[model samples]
Target: MNLDLLKRTRMYKGYNQYQMAEGIGLTRQTYNYKENGKSSFNSDELLRITTFLDLSFKEVNEIFFDNLISK
Candidate 1:
C-alpha cells in the first residue's frame, strides 16, 4: 500500500489520523494501519478516502493504483 502518500496527504490537509479516519468513516486504528503500511484497503475504503480527501478520481487512481493495471 502507498502508505507514504496516505500520510503525506493527510498532513498536507492538516489532519491527524484520527480526524481523517472519522472524516472517511473508518476506525482510527484501521486508518492508522493503512497509513503505517500494515494493511490494504478494500474498494469501499478507497472510495471513502478519495471522497473525504476531496481528490479527483484521477488523483486517487494515481496515488493508490500504482500497482494495478487494466485487464
Candidate 2:
C-alpha cells in the first residue's frame, strides 16, 4: 500500500485508523502496520478501503497502484 497516500487521503476525509480498520474488517494494529507500509494489503483489503473511501478509478490507481495515470 502507498502509506503516504493512505494517510493523506484518510485524514483528508476525516477517517481515523480505528474507523478505517473496522470498515475494512481488520484489527487496528494490522491496519496500522499495513497503512505504515509494513504489511501488504491484499485485493480484498484494497477493495474494502476503496469502497469505504469512495475512491474513483483514477484515485484508486493513484493511491493503490501509484500509477497516477490521467483519467
Candidate 3:
C-alpha cells in the first residue's frame, strides 16, 4: 500500500491515528497496522476510510490501486 499520501492528508486534517481510526469505526491498533502496510484493507474498511477521509474515487485509486493500474 502506498500510504504516503494518506499520511500527509491525515496530518493536514489534524487527525491523529486514533482519531482517524475511530472516525472510520476501527481500533487504533488495526488502523496502525493497516497504515503501516502490515495488513491490506478489506472492501468495507476501504469504504469506511474513504468516507472518513472524504476521498474521491480517483484519489482512492491513486493511493491504493497504483499497483493494479501498473499491471
Listed per model in order, the count of residue pairs whose N, CA or C atoms clash below 3 Å is 0, 0, 0
| Candidate No. with top TM-score | 2
Error of 1 at 53 (Å): 0.3
C-alpha lDDT of all candidate models, in order:
0.81, 0.89, 0.83
Query: How does candidate 3 fare on TM-score?
Result: 0.82
For model 2, residues 1-71, the per-residue Cα lDDT tens digits are: 46798899999999999999998899999999999988899999999999999998977988887885665
Backbone clashes in model 3, listed as residue pairs: none
Q: Write down the RMSD of candidate 2 (Cα, Å).
A: 1.6
lDDT of 3: 0.83
16-56, model 1: which lDDT tens digit per residue? 98999898888999888888878888889888888888876
Across residues 1-71, which tens digit of lDDT does each residue of candidate 3 receive?
A: 57888888787878999999999898999999989888887989888888888887677877778646642
Could you tell me every candidate's TM-score relative to the true structure? 0.80, 0.89, 0.82
Candidate 1 regions off by >4 Å? Answer: 67-71
Clash number for candidate 1: 0
For candidate 2, the lDDT comes to 0.89
